[model samples]
Target: MTSVTSLPASEQEGARTSPEDPEKLEDPEKATLSTDPSETSLPNNKRVEQPTKINWLLTCVGLYLGALLYGLDTTVAATVQASVYEELGNLQKLPWVGIGFPLGSVAVILLIGKLYDTFEIKWLIIGSVTLFEAGSALCGAAPTSNALIVGRVIAGMGGAGMYIGALNYISIFTTSMQRPIYNALIGLCWGTGAILGPVVGGAFSDSSAKWRWAFYINLPLAAVVSPLYFLNFPRYNPQPEHTALEKFKQIDWLGAFLNASTFVLFILILSFQGPIWRWAAPGSIVLWVLFGLSLISYGLQQTFSILTSPERRLFPIDFLARRTLLLMFFATSSAAAATSVTLYYVPLFFQFTKGDNALEACVRLLPFIVPFVFFVMFSGGLLPVVERYAPWYFPAGVLMIVGGALMYKVSPNTYTAAIYGFEILIAIGTGLVFQTGYAVVAAKVPAHRVAASIGFINIAQIGSICITLAIAGSIFGNLGFVKLEHVLTGYGFTDSELRSALAGSFSPVFQHGDARARKLAIEAVVSTMGTSFALVFVAGAVTLVSAFCMRWEKLGLQTTAGG
Candidate 1:
């Protein structure tokens, strides 16, 4: 260097630096500096860091809060439906209030989950939350039943996106070590929502507040969370090398369409079967046919996607093939069906049989909700101690079966303690199985597809609920008040008197009657409702059978230290 030897082409330009330059190459500090622009322009790995631990914690808290809102929205409408129906003066349309939210939410869950996979989730969350608040506001202001239904439908869209997005985000953000806690948090949110829905609805309805306040309450919560979410949540910018169009092309839109159609048609058909259309009606038959065709189309599309894709499709056939996932689906579906059946009939029983008002009816249901919350928390703790889920699964099935059988035994004169005990059995069964099923599915499926799997499981669950509710409603309708009145005519009660008494509810048939007449009428109602419980028992038995089909080892039979 001192001899001034010729430099390479690249270095020659730098060596001939002008005197105007800040420093000469002979300077030690200057010599150490990188003259190459590329070297100096390179990104600093240490300087450009990822989100801090505090940011992650905040994100999780936000997601958990979002999940709570999602679950609460699903059932809160149910508690206020009676009031809504009474105000609207259409008891026939009452079921729609409960059905609309779940149907709409279930319809979009898988699609939304897949969208999250293909696109940025943060925007979807923002849009969903905004939609939720708007819907809530609209519902609060609605003057007609149709307007309220529209609001509910809009809210359901938001709920579907929020729920699926939360699950997807949690799955991606949490490590295996954190999954147990993360999943437990989700379970807690759902459980809490289920518990609070009745209480909130009852309180609002019982007070001077209109039933509309139930929908309105969501707005303030949404406003508070939205800004915090926008500020603190990390922006997920996809690498620019891949354009948005290319990403969009990768989504299976056809699959989405078919899946939505299938659910819509299926739910519509199920809804029509009870009072809208007789079981054997031609319109019902056509709906069933349409539902079948849609299902077939959905399956074919999925199959084609799997066969034709260059990369593995989002829904791999192998995931569905997993025995653990299948069993978990059945377990969840049956448990959900049981819960739906209980919720549908219990209030009616309290109102009619027990002569309880709306608030009192809801309070009477505490036996189910209280035990459910307790068992859910208790099971989260016990999961770490138990090595296998099979033990829990078996007991859960037994409890459900026993509960259904005992509930079938309830009569006009049945002791309050017995009724509470039966409710406890149902609650324990539901709580034990629900979280365990999710755990099993998560264990069997790839981590990335957990949201999709959950969506599918929830679809099955909602499907079961819809079908069971329809069947129960059909049974109730078929056993008309007129028929019941005629049956009670020979009990020293005139036809006019019987009609007036039975007009309000099926309860007077059970209570405030001659001993022999009460016994017969109660027997008749029980025998009729027994058919519904029999279906529940059958569902429980199927769950038990499916439990044995799950591969224990594959389902993480070796429990984690903190599961």
Candidate 2:
């Protein structure tokens, strides 16, 4: 799903290899991909002699480590929230802890994409890793809630770059023929990290070192993995004509600012409107107005700003004109939304219904994670050989819809085996298409736009998590509160007590309640969770619809000699 750029032909004439050249690569089946004859070789795409198997493996490890950090940090905050709230004493501000990281990524994603296109990628990746580690350090040592939020934002910013850089690295190092499997492997790393995030966080929360290790853990991992980047990552400028200062001056700063403002306002509106502020509250209304203005301004800037051009604009608005690209964009968004909402609430299902702690809830989720990881690998490896990308989504969507519906019916009495079965269905569905977008865009788009296109899809993936989580939170909290009142009215519980109980079965209200009251509360939580699962069902439907409309085109992967 991602790609690279390369140097001009005039500078790279000596490095170019004819397709007919019978050079023996380390892998007999592996062939070096040449730059397109009709197109200029850009920075990241410069053809080079194939690396030894060891070098290739090490670079992949380095890239996967970057991806693992992003994925681990993504949901680790969810598990740490209760611990952080207990220590920091700001239960009201808990939502921001999760929002801060993705907000940072969404705000700057397009700008980061442009930077990758313009800068030396290895140094950019180095800078990204350094920023991520620095932010993690800040998070580990934070004295105040605000500082922790800031650290999360910083980490998210850095994590986005590292994540997208992984895709670009694959695109640079592998041929189109080899990219699907590699991209899938990146997904494997990312999915495994995300699935383990809460587990690791919970383990740490239950340990002597406690929640800070969730952030501190990244430091040691980076120390072990980053040396490969410094030593093995290739260095080149795709746009050799542009001096660093010239490229810097050409960046659309105003467009980037407006784009960042648009996402920040929109995320704020979603985060605050239902839970913290009334929809009509001045705070919420101001956010809505600012979001509107920022969105309109960004659209105008993309279309008509004197400062913007094909080369300088942060977003790939031109790609939107293509039907395939547009479909892929929304499909990727829907798939990500479906996957995130499912992953998030499945744990909550156990926490409420089975009275499990974070670690226990996570432990119960292995049924889902194992199948999802396997299918992600399976689908990625299958894509190149099968040569068809469009048809894969149909079955995936159906499985998700079926899986989501089954989960929506989950209750306090649901059997452990049944819950695991439903989760397996959803996991298989999601894993099939999770990394497909990258491979599709990598094959479908022009080589030059690979980095930007990857960033564009990434915004969908990360932004959907923030947006869907906010909406899902509102739905779960409000609906559960209403249900609790209806069910527990005879018990004389206060609104505050009802709200606290919605935290989970571990809350003081639930933990202290009589057996009957605890049973009723669990039932209400289960019902509200069912409503929340409807979001995933709807997301699956959207994916189905989008995929149905897509053209059945084969991904043109060159596998043979000279191909």
Candidate 3:
């Protein structure tokens, strides 16, 4: 290994050896050196750091279980939304329950990632878990819609922190090759919690237990796992000592605030459009303008301000400016957009078009859900073995496109086997792409910038999910209602019946009198959903196109200093 004194400042900060110099790099473990500033900067300050031997199995169990906490809230909350609405009698406040956590999470994610980069990770992990537990307690005990929403937001911050913290944690302990395995496990756990969330919520909702138990469930698990965090987690020496005021100046507070505000407002605009106001309504227009201004201001801040100057930009513009990263962003966004939209609508296809009950549709979705987790784990396992990640990128794109195309052909009477095959295809495709961003980013970025890089990737995924859901909702709202109204009127259903049907769930249309009218309404739903799924195909196509620009890179086991 090269001495710190021998390298240039750029190298010290996070420069890597040229690919031509691969033979000169350290063993993979040595290559992933702790980027603690105190270790590198103080030449004579003899800090004899040594690697901590971890029980990887115990570590994996603790980490994946912690990962599940983030997903449980969303899934469980979604399941109990109806009961919540019934009990609270304020349906308008319901969306806030969803909005609050992500908003709080977005606010802190960018900064928190950087914090983990330079601080004691153990405390951060423990604190985040404690925060999550605290929020869960509040939600379980909340007496009003507003109270629950507030608790959700607090917990969301903790979750966002946990997610990034998990990434940082793996990077700290596991070699580059081992990271995908842990990432896969974490992704699968999160995915499992999500798939099971509604079911668990339903169980509690139906049982003598209150829906609040859904939130409360997190308590014991968190309590049990926190001890492992302290015992097994490695420690890093803090960066060169600085006074409180000096260290405070180092953070990009302005940039973080601006970016957080912009995302929150963006979510607000989407949340308001349907539940509260029309797009053309004054409230919508006002929020739209606010969102636009906030975004523009954030961009300017990143470009100009000292707090968010080019050197310390909250988003790390130079890193993201690379063609490879941009394409990755596009690929992830398109894939997430595709998967999220499909996940949102596929169950509807079974429920509305085929008239399966909600529970039955959920059960039918198990094929897709099960394969998704399997492939996510499978792909994670595979990445470590593959010589080049780029080769796998193409197949991921191909499978997503193929799966999405098949999904587009779905109808009320489509073969059960066909849908199952299509879902499995998509699931496998998703698993391939899901971890690509994290692994590739880790491979490319310097240790100092790793957390920031992961956070950026996280933001892209979240942004796509939010935007895709909103667009999908709009399309479903516009197309479903229009088609049903036209079909119902054609079948001699009165305008009043059409109005009532349009205002609520389409299930009633099937329940109403007149068999012919029901048939038309069912057809209308199928047609509308087909159009929606077609957009998912579009998402797949976008991913395929973007994959071309994502450069092929080999995952070398040899590590480089602070790489």
- Please name the candidate that would achieve the greatest lDDT relative to the true structure: 2
TM-score of 1: 0.80
| Model 3 bad stretches (over 4 Å) | 1-57, 92-100, 237-240, 243-245, 353-360, 478-527, 558-563
Q: lDDT (0-100) at residue 150 of candidate 1? A: 76
* TM-scores of the candidates in the order shown: 0.80, 0.89, 0.82
lDDT values for all models: 0.63, 0.77, 0.65
Q: What is the lDDT of residue 492 in candidate 3?
A: 57
Q: Could you tell me how far off, in angstroms, the CA of residue 62 lies in candidate 3 after the best superposition?
A: 2.3
**Worst-scoring 10-residue span by lDDT in model 1:** 40-49
Ranking by TM-score: 2, 3, 1
- C-alpha lDDT (0 to 100) for residue 340 of candidate 1: 70
Better of 2 and 3 by TM-score: 2
Where model 2 places Cα greater than 4 Å from the true spot, the runs are 1-53, 490-494, 558-563
Which residue pairs show backbone clashes in model 1?
Answer: none
Leading candidate by TM-score: 2
Q: What value of lDDT does candidate 1 attain over all alpha carbons? A: 0.63
Q: Per-residue lDDT for 359-469 in model 2, tens only?
A: 898898899889989999998888877777788789888888988888888888999999999889888888888888887776555455567778878877887877787
